[model samples]
Target chain A: MSLLSVRDLTVKFSNRGQSVTALNGISFDIARGERVGVVGESGAGKSITGFAMMNLLSRPGYIDGGQVLFEGKDVLKMSAREQRSLRGNRMAMIFQDPMVTLNPVLTIGQQMVETLRAHRKLSHEEARQIATVKLKEVYIPSPEARLDQYPHELSGGMRQRIVIAMALLLDPQLIIADEPTTALDVTIQADIMELLLEMCRSNMVGLMLITHDLGVVSQVTERTLVMYAGRIIEAGKTRSIINDPQHPYTQGLINALPQQTPPGSRLKQIPGSMPSLNAMPSGCPFHPRCPLANDLCRTTMPKVVQYADVEVACHEVQRLQSDLTSEAAQ
Target chain B: MLQYTFRRTIAVLPTILCLIVICFFLMRLAPGGPFTSERPLPPAIMANVLERYGLDQPLYVQLFTYLKNIFFNFDFGPSFAQRDRDVNDIIAAGFPVTLTYGFWSAVFVLVLGIPLGVIAALRQNSFWDYVMTGFAIFSQIFPNFVLAPLMVLTFTLALGLLPGGGWNGGQWEYVVMPAVALGTSYLANVARITRSSLLEVLGSPYIRTARAKGLPERTIMIRHALKPTLLPVISYMSPVFVYMITGSVFIDVFFSTGGIGQSFIDAAYTRDYSVILGLAILYSVLTFVLNLAVDLAYAAIDPKVRSGLK
Candidate 1:
C-alpha cells in the first residue's frame, strides 16, 4: 500500500471574494520508501500541493476539494487533534530557505526537542537524545553544540541540514521536502540533496521532493511528476521521463537544462512564461508555451492518459512519442 | 553580554550629565524665580531668602552648586513652594502610587493585549480579527486622558462598580480604573505591534515548517511564533515604561493620585526649582536605565541579538 495517496487534490485561493483554483484536481501517490519529485515553475502550485496534503495551506489558500489519504486515514477529514497527531509524527516536512525556516529566537536544540516532545511521551532529555542522533545522521559536527545555537549562527547549508535533521527527528513515514535546497548555494545544493536522499533511504522513509531543478529530480527521485500551472502534465519512472518525455512541457523543461545546450551556446527555453493562475489558458495551461499546440489543443483540455512509458496530458503525445523513437534510431 | 551591558551603562554618565545641565539651565532660562510670590515679600526678607538658598549668586555658580549637591550630597534641596518638605522625600512619597498603577497597567497590557493580538493573527480576516483591530484603533485614538474620564463615567457614575477617582493609597479597587485608563493606549500599541509582526511571522516559512510538524496550533503559536512577534513590541514598550513610572498628569489630576507628574508640574507653575530639578533628574535616569534594560532583554529573547552582543 502507498504511504501517501493524493487523489483529485484541488486547492483554491480566495482573495477579496474571488476564488481561483491553485491546484486543479492534481493527484499522485508515494509508495513506502519511494522518492517522488514534483517539478514545476514558481507558480505551478508545486508547493501548494505539498501544503494541501498536510492540510496546512495558509489563508487565502485552502483545500477546495481533495482526499489526502495517509496511512489509510483521510487527512482532510481528520479532526484537528487527529491531524495534529499525524503531522510531524508520521509525516514531516522540510521547507525551502532554511535561513528563515527555523525560528530566529529559538535555539536549534529547543526547536528539535519541542517537535519530538510534541508527538511523543518523552522528557526533554530523551527528546534531546533523539534530536542529537538525528543531527549526527545529517553529518552535523559537535551535534550537542549545534543544538544550542540559533539558525542565524549557522551557514545556509548548515541551517538546511538542521532543518533536515528536524524533519527526520520523529522518524516519519514520509517527508515532504518543498524545494529544500532552493535557497542554498549551488555548491552546497548538491551536498544537502545528497544528505536528504541518504537519510530517507537509510530510514526507509518515503519522500515527496518538490523542486524546479530537473537535474536534482533525476538524480534523487525514483518517480517524477511534472507540474505546470496547477496540474500534472507528465509523470512516470524518473528514468523513462528523462529519456522519453511525452508532454511538450516536459520536453521543454528537459531541453532547457543547461547540459542539454551545446557548450557556450544559448540554453533552449520554452518560448513563453507560465500563464498567471488568475488568467490560465483555456485548453491547457502549458499550451501557450508549447510549440506543438494546435487548435484542438487550444479548444480541448487534455486529460492524463497512458502514453509510451509515461502518463501524459497533451494532444501531441502520440506525435512526440513517434518523433522520439525515430530520433533515437537516427 | 555582561561586558556589553556594563560598557553601555558606563557610557550613559556623560549623557545624563549633559541632560541634567541642559534641563537645569533651561528651567532657569524660564521666567520667574523660586521666590516670586504674588504679593512680594519685603525686600529684606526676599534678600535673606535668596541669600539662604544661594539664588543671589551667579547663574554658573548656582548650576555648579545644584549639580554638586545632587551628585555628591545626594540632596534635591528643599521645595521652595512648600518650605517644610524636601524634594527627595516628596518625590519618594508620590512614587508608590504611580508605580502601583504602572505595574498593573503593564500586567494588563501583556496579559490581555498579547493574546488579543495572537488571536487576531491566527484568525486573520475573521470576525475576531476585525473586532481586535477595531478595538486596537479605538484604544489608540482615545489616549489615557480621554479614556480616563470615560472610564470614571462608566465604572463610577454609570455602572458604579468602582471608585471614580482617588488611589485610596494603592488599594486594588482604586487601582483597577487607573490601570485601564493608563493601559488602553499602551495595550493598543502592543496589540497592534504583536498582530502585525505575528501576522508576518505566521506567513514566514518557518511557521509553515512548524505547522507541517503536526504540532497543535497552540503549540506552534506559543513556541514558534510568540518570541519573534515580541521583538518589536518590546522595543515599543521601552519609553512607555518610563512614562508609566513617572505617571501622567491626566492620570494624576483625574484620579487625584499625587504622583511625580503632579508634583513636578505644580513645581513648574510655582517655579519651585529644587522640586522641578529633582523630578527631571529622576526621569532622565529612569529613562536611560529602562532603555538599557530593554537592550539587555533583547539579547535574552533573541539569540541573534545575543550573538551580536558577544
Candidate 2:
C-alpha cells in the first residue's frame, strides 16, 4: 500500500463572502520510500497541498473535500486524538523558513524531546538520546551540544538541520518537506538537500517535497508533479519531465531556468503570472499563457493523457502526440 | 547578562536625578503651600515652619538640600501638611496595602487575562471570542474611577457579600473589589494584547511546525505560542504594573483602602513638598526597576534577546 494516498483532495477558502478554491481536486500518491516533488510558483497552492494533506490548514482555508489516506487509513476521518497520533508518528513535515520553523524560545533538545514525547510515553533522557541520534542522522556536527542551544543560536543551515532532526525524532514513515532550504545559502542548500535525501533513503521514509525549484526537484525527487493554478498539469519521472516537458507550462518553467540560457543572456520567462484563484480563467488554467492554445483549450479543461512515461493535461500535447503518430504511420 | 544588569542599574541614577529635579521645580512653581489652610496659622508660625524645614531657602539651596538628604541619609523629611509625620512613615504605612492590592491585581490580570486572551485568539470568530472581545472593550471604556464605584455598589451594597471599603484588617475579602477594579482595565489591555499577539504568532511558521509535529492544541499554544505572545504584553504591562503598585488614587479613595494612591492625591492637593517629592522619587524608582525587570524578563523568555546579551 502507498504510504500516503491523497485522493480527490480539494481545499477552499471563504474570503469576504466569496469562495476561493485553493486546491481544485488534485490527486496523487506516494509509496513507501518514494520521493515525489510538487513544484509550482507561489500561490499555486503547493504549500497548501502539504498543509491540507496534514489536516493543518488554518482558518479561512480548510479541506473542503478530500481523502488523505496514510497507510490506507483516511486521515480526515480520524478523530482528533487519532489525527494527533498519526501526525509526527506516521507522518512528519519540514517547513520553508528554517529560521522560523523551530520555536525561538525553546532549546533544540526541548523541541525535539517534546515532539518525541507527544506521541510516545518516553522519559526525558530517552527522548534526548533519540533526539541526539536523529540530529547526528541529519549530519549536524557535535549533535549533543546542539540539543541544548536554541534555534536563534544556530545558523540558518543549522536550524534547518535541527528542524529536520526534529521531524525524524519519531521515526515517521512519511516526511513532507515544503521548500525546506529556500531560506539558506546556496552552498548550505545543496548540503541540506543531500542530507535530507540520504536520511530518507537510509530510513526508507517516503518524502513529499513541495518546492518551486525545478533544479532541486530534478536532483532529489524521483517523481515530479508540476502544478499550475492549483492543478497538477504534468507528472512523470523527474529526469524525463526535466529533459522533455510535455505541458507548455512545465516547458515554460524548465526553459526559464538560468542554466538553460547561455552566459549573460536574459533568462526565458513564462508570459503572465499564475491566475488568482477568484479570477481563474475558464477551462484550462494555463491556456491564457499557452503558446499552442486553441478554442477547445480556451473553453474546456483537457483530460490527462498518457504519452510514454508522462501524464500531461493539455489539448495541445495530446494533438501533437497524435499528429506525430499519424505522420510516423504515413 | 550580569554586565547588562549592572549597566541597567547604573543607568537608573541619571533618570532618578532628572525626575527629582523636574518634580522639585514643578512643585515649587505651583501656587500653593502646605500651610495654606482654610484656618490659616499666624504668619510668625508659618514663617517659623518654613524656616525650620529649610523651605524658606532659595530654590537652588532647597533643591540641593533635598538631594543631599535623599542621597546621604535617605531622608524624605517630615510631611508639611500633616505635622510630625515624615514622608517615609506615610509611605511605609500605606505602601504595604497598595502592594497587596497591586500584587493580587497582577495575579488576576495574568491568571485571568492571559488564558482568556489565548482562548479568544484560538476561537477567533467564535461566540466566545466575540464575548471576550466585547468584555475587553467594555473594561477599557470603564476606567478605575468609574469601575471602582460600580463594583462597590454591586458587591458591597447590592450583593452584601463583601465589605464596601477599607482594608478590613488586611483580609482577603477586602482585597477582591479593589483589586478587580484596579486590574479590570489592565486585564482588558493585557487580554487584547495577548489575543492580537498570539493570533499573529499562531500564524507564524513555527506554530505550523508545532502542529505538523503532532503536538496537541494545548501544548502547541503553551509551548510554541505563549512565549512570543508575551513579549509585547510584558513591555505593555510594565508601566501599568507600576501604576497599580503606586496605587490608583481614585480606587483607593472610593474603596477607602488608605493605600499610597490616596496619600499621593492628598499630598498633591495640600502641596506637601516633602511627601509629594518623596512619592515622585518612589514612583520614578519603581518605574526604573519595573522596566529593568521587564528587560531582564524579555531576555530570559526570548532566546534572541538572550543571544544578543551574550
Candidate 3:
C-alpha cells in the first residue's frame, strides 16, 4: 500500500458568497520512499495540494471533498489532536522562502526542539541532542554553535538547510517541500536541491516536491504530475514526461524550458496566461492555452485516461493514443 | 548591548544641553518676565522682586547663573508663580503622583491591549474582531479630556463603582479612573498596533512554517508570533511611555493629581522660568533614556539589530 494516497481530493474557495473550485477532484499517490513532483504556473494550486494534504489550508480555501489517507487512515477524518500527531511526526513540510520560514525571534535550537517535543515527550536536553544530530546530518557546520544563533544570523542557504533538518528531525515518513530552493541564489539552488534529494534518499523518506521548474523536477522526481488550472492535465514517469510530454499543456511547459531552446533565442511560451480561478474557462481548464484544443475539449472536461505509462486528461491525447495503436496494428 | 547603551547615553547629553540653551533663550525672548502680571506691579515692588531673584542682571548673566545653579548647586530656584515654593519642592511632591498613575496606566494598557489584539488577529473577520476594531477607533477619536469626565460620571456618579477625583496619596481605588482615562489612548493605540502587527506577522511565511510544524494554534501565536508583533508596538511606546511616566497635564488637572505635567502647564501660563526649565530638563532626560532603552530592547529581541545598535 502507498504511504500517502490522495483520493479524489477537492478544494474550494468561497469568496464573496460564490464558491470556486481550487482543486478539482485531484487524485494521486506516493508509496514509501517515492519522490513525486507537482508542477504548474503561479495560480495552478500546486501549493494548495500540499497544504490540503496537511489540512493546513488558510481560511476560505477548504477541503470540499477528499480523502487524504496516510498509512491507510483518512487524515481528513482525524481529530485535531490526531491530525497534529500525524503532521510533523509522520509527515512534515518544508516551505519556500527560507529567509522567512523560521521564526525571526526564536533561536535555531528553540524552533527545532519545540517541533521535536511537540510529537514526543522528550526532555529539553534530549530534544537538543536529537536536534544536533539532525543538523549534523544536514551538513551544518558546528551544529552546537548554530543552535544558539537566530534565523537572521544565518544565510539563506543555511536557513533552508536548517528548515530541511527540522523537517527530518522526527523521522517523518513523508516530507512535502514546496519550492524549497526557489528563494535561494542560482548557485545555491543546485546545492540545496542535491542536499534535500540526498537526505530524502538516505532516510528512505517519501518526498512530494512542488515547483514550476521542470529542470529541477526532472532531476529530483521519479514521477511528475503536471497541473493546469486546478486539475492534473498529465502525469507519468518524470523521464518520459520530460522527454515526450503527452498533453498539449505539458508539451508547452516542457518545451518552454530555456534548455529546450537554442541559446540567445527567444524561449517558447504558452500563448495565453492561466485563467483566473473565478473566471476559469469551461471544459478542460487548459483548453484556452492548449494548441490542440477542439470543440470537444472546449465543451467537456476531459477525464483522466490511462495509457501504457501515462495517465493524461486531454481529448487530443486520448485520440492520438488510439491512432497510434491502430497504425501499429496495420 | 552594554557598549551600545553607553554610547547612546553619551549622545543624549548634547541633545539635552541644546534643549536647555534654546528653551532658556526662548523663554526670555517672550515679552514676559517671571514677574509679569496682567495688573502691573508697583515699579519699586517689581524692581525689588527682580533683584531678589537675580533677574535684574544682564540676560546672558542670568542664563549663565541659571545654568550654574542647575548644574552646580542642583537648585531649580524658587517658583515665581507660587509663593514661597521652589521648583524642586513642586517636583518632589508631584513626581511620585505621576509615577503611580504612569506605572498603573502602562500596566493597564499593555495587559488589556495585547491580548485583545491577539484575539482580534486570530479571529480576523469575526464579530469580536469587528467589535475590537470599532472600540479601538472609538477610543482613538475620544481624547482624555472627553474620556476623563465621562469616566468620572459613569464610574463615579452614575455607577458609583469608584471615586470621582483626588489622588488620595496614590491609593489604588483613587488611581483607577485616572489611570484608565490616561490609558484609554495608549490602550487603543496598542490594540490597533498589536492587531495589525500580529496580523502581518501571522501572514508571514515564518508563522505559516510554525503552523506547518504541527504546533497548536495557541503555541504558534504565543511563541512564534508574539515577539515580532511586539516590535512595532514597542517602538510606538518609547515617547508615549516617557510622557506618561513623567505626567500628562490633563490627567493631573482632571484627576486633581499633583504631577509635574500640571505644574509645567501652570508655570507656562504664569511664565515661571525656573519651573518651566526644570520640567523641560526632566522631560528631555526621560525621553533620551527611554529611547536608549527601546534600542536595547530591539537588540534583545533581534540579534540582527544588535550590531546596528552599537
Q: Which of the CAPRI classes, incorrect, acceptable, medium or high, describes model 1?
A: medium
Candidate 2: count the clashes.
0
lDDT of 1 at A308: 81
Task: List runs of model 1 lying over 4 Å from the truth.
Answer: A319-330, B1-4, B37-43, B154-163
TM-score of chain A, cand. 2: 0.97
- The candidate maximizing DockQ is 2
lDDT of 2 by residue, A134-253 (tens): 888788899999989988778999988888888888788999999998899999999999999998999999999999898889889999999988888899999989998899898899
Per-residue lDDT of A1-330 in model 1, one digit per residue for the tens?
788889999999998899998999988989999999999899999988988888988787888887999977899999998999888889999888888888888889988988888899999999999999989989999999998888888899999999999988888999999999989899999999999999989999999999999889999999999998899989999999999988888888889999999999999988979888789888977777778779988888887778888999887885666687899999
Q: Recovered native contacts in candidate 3, as a fraction? A: 0.82
- Per-residue alpha-carbon lDDT of model 3 for B55-155, expressed as tens digits? 88998898888888888999988898889999899989989999889989989999999989888888889998998989988897888899999988888
Query: Could you give candidate 1's per-residue lDDT for residues B189-305 as a string of tens digits?
Result: 788888999989888988888888777778777788878889999999899888886778778878888877788778889899888888888888888888889888888888877
Query: What local lDDT does model 3 show for residue B16?
Result: 81
Q: What is the lDDT of residue A251 in candidate 3?
A: 85
Report, for every candidate in turn, its global Cα lDDT versus the true structure: 0.87, 0.89, 0.90
- Shares of reference contacts reproduced by the candidates, in order, are 0.89, 0.93, 0.82
Model 1 residue B273 CA deviation (Å) reads 1.4
